[model samples]
Structures are given as C-alpha cells and as structure tokens.
Target: MIWKTIKVNFHRLGSPPTFYRLAEVLAPWLWGGFAVCAAIGLYQALYVVPPDYQQSDSFRILYIHVPSAWQAMAGYVVMTILAVIALVWRIRTVEIMAMAGAPIGAAFTFICLATGSLWGRPMWGTWWAWDARLTSMLVLLFIYLGIMGLYAAFEDRRKGARVACILILVGIVNIPIIHFSVEWWTTLHQGATIRLFSGESTLHESMMPPLVWMTIAVKLMFGAALLDRARNDLLDQDRRKGWVQSRLGETA
Candidate 1:
C-alpha cells in the first residue's frame, strides 16, 4: 500500500507544472538555509578552529576544499541519476533536470580543482601533481565539459539529451575512481578524515562543527541552485504551452 501511494505521488509530482510549483515553494527555504548555515560555518572555520600543528593556518583550506570536492562529485551522481530516469521513463522534466544539472556540476568541479591546487601549492610545494586523486578528478571535469559540449552540438534538443544521457552513464565509472584513488594508490592527498560506519574523524571538536555546517550549507546551496536552474529550463521547455502563456499574461 505504501509503495503504491509513493508511486502515485511520484508520478503526480513528475508533471512539469507540479514540479515547477514545488520548486517555487522550496527555493526560499533552500536559500535561507544556505545563508544561515554558511555564515555560521565561516565564523567557526575562521575563528574557532585552531591552527594545525604541521600545516598551521594553511590547513584551513580544507573547509573550502573538502566541501567543494564532496559537492562536485555529488552533483555528478545527481545528474547521472536524473539522466537515467530521463532515458528510461522518457520524462521531459527529468531530462531538463539532467541538462540543467550539468553546468552546476561543472562549476563545482572547477572550484574543486582550483581550490585543491591552491591548497597544494602551500603544502606540496607545487601547484599541481599527477596524483591519482587529482588526475581522476581532472578527468571528471573533462567529462563534464564533454557532456556540455555534446549537448550543445545538436540543434535538435531531444536527440542531444539522449546522447548526453548515454555519456553521463558511461562517465559514472569515474566517480568511484575519484573517491577511492587516495586509498588505492600512493598519493599526496590524505585519506578520509571522516568515517561513516564508525563515529571517527581526524578533525578536532572545534573544527568538526564548522566542517559539518559547511558541508550542509554547500548541499543546501546546491539544492537552491539546482531548483532555480530546473525552473528556468522548464520555462524554456514550455514557453509555447498554454499554461506558460497564461502565467506570462498574468504577470504582464
């Protein structure tokens, strides 16, 4: 009974109009959470967390570097899942989600690479390295670029979406490589600081709270950005439809 109920609701919300309305309702809350949490996280990260014994203040880069890396990979997984839905179910809204998600994911991946390089300069005494984690992450960024480029190449948007979906599915393999590269091979990068199974983290108590807050803040920010992008894509997709015409008329 519960599964049937969930299936019904999922289909109902899958409709473009319903999803647009839901996005509208969610946008403010997501942005508000992002603002509050980010402010608190920044305060704690800058003032509360003490300097590292080895790296000193340079260690502070993890606050930005860690969250950006996590979010970058997370965004790709989200795009891949939505792409699968679009491909299997032939849902236009999900297709738009997949399309809209790519640029955002790409942006985060770029940030991850940039910040990681900045962190490395002070610690590794170099601007870049062909380390396993870094190389895999660079490949992830190139995949993102390829997806975007492929989608833009076709004048027929539907055909473009189909091809992009296939590319995303293929690129899903790199995500695991990025996550385990530090463990699988020797690298300048450190191992995981936080463990999910055990309540174990390498960070001190003062540092952990800010890191936690920053992670949540980044996720919320991603949600807000994704919804905003999806909403805009829906507008572009449905511009010729009666509902969008009426909505535009009312606003005008």
Candidate 2:
C-alpha cells in the first residue's frame, strides 16, 4: 500500500499542474541550497585550499572551471535523457524540462570555455589549442548552440521540441568524446584528477572538499533554475486555462 501510494504520487508529479505546484514549493529551497553551498565552496576554494605547487594562485580558478565544465556535460546528459522520456511518453512537462535545460547547459559550457582559456593562457602559454579534449569541448558547445537554434526555428514549439529531441539524442555521441578525448589521443590537457575507479582523487584533502562543494552548488543551481524555467513554461502554455486564470486572478 505504501509503495503503491508513492508510485501514484510520482506519476501525478509528472503532470503539469502538480509539477507547477511542486516547483513553487521546491524552488526557494533549491536556490537556498545553491547559495549556501556556493558560499562555503568559494570561501574554501579561494582561501582554505593551498595553492598548487605547480600552478600557484592561478590554479584557484579550478574551483569555478571544473564545476562548470562538469555541469556543462552533465546538463546535456540530463536533457538528453529527459528528451527521450518526452519523446517516448509524450509528456509535455518532460519536454519543457528538456527545453528549459538547454540555456543553462549552454551557459555552463560557455563558462567552461572562458575559464579554460584563462587557465590555459598562463599554463599552456596559449589561449586556444587544438588538443583533443579542448577541441571536443568546443564541439560540445556548438552542439548545445545547435539544439537551441533548431528549437527556435520551428513555428510550433511542440514540433520544435520534437526536432530538438532528436538532435539531443544524436548529439549525445559527443559527451563520451569530450570525456575520453584526453585518454584517446595525445593531448595537452591533463588527465582526470578525480578518478571514479581505483586510487582516490589526486587532489589533496583540503582541495577536494571545496571542489566537491562547488560541484554540489552548481548542481543545486541547475535544479533550481531548471524548475523555475519549467514552471514558467507551464504557466505560459496554460495561460488561457482556468487554473492559470484563477491563479493569476488571486495574485492580482
């Protein structure tokens, strides 16, 4: 009985009205989590963590750069998965989720590019390189842009979403390329410091905490932003419906 009730609630949560209400309840908490995590993470990253013996103070940018890069890739994976659900189930809310996630993904990708350039300039002595990892990341950025552009081209957003969903699935090929490029080919970019298997992270204990915190912060920010955007999309879509009219009437 308990399991059945939970399953029922989960299904209802996928509906637009239920999701809109849930977003309203959850957005503030998620945003607050982002703020708190970001604050602690930045403090630890900027002041608590010791400077890299190799790169010196410049390496501090890793706090921002790594998290942004991680989220940039992670965001695409999430959108692609949601896109698949949207396509298979014909769930409009899930479709909105995919659309809402694209801009945030693109923003993080741009940050990754900019911060990577900054990191590279002093370390690699060049702002840009054709290194496999760097090139693949750049390609990832273009794919994100392509998704947004393709979505905007169609007169009907529903059709646009269907088209973009296909693109997302096709573009997922790039995620692995971005991740494994360093291993696959000769590259100037250093290998992963935080290995999931085998030995623990290469980072010192003090450094690892801040990086973890920042990663959590970015994820919370993504969730909060995604929910807010999805909620707005729902309201826009249902603007003429009675529930939305009543909600607006109450607010007015």
Model 1 lDDT, full chain set: 0.89
Clash pairs detected, candidate 1:
none
Error of 1 at 119 (Å): 1.4
- C-alpha RMSD by candidate, in order: 1.6, 1.2
CA shift at 181, candidate 2, in angstroms? 0.5
The models' CA-based lDDT, in order, is 0.89, 0.92
**Candidate 1 on 189-238: residue-level lDDT in tens?**
88888887876877777779888999999999999999999899789878
- Which ranges of candidate 1 are over 4 A from the true structure? 1-5
Candidates in order, TM-scores: namely: 0.94, 0.96
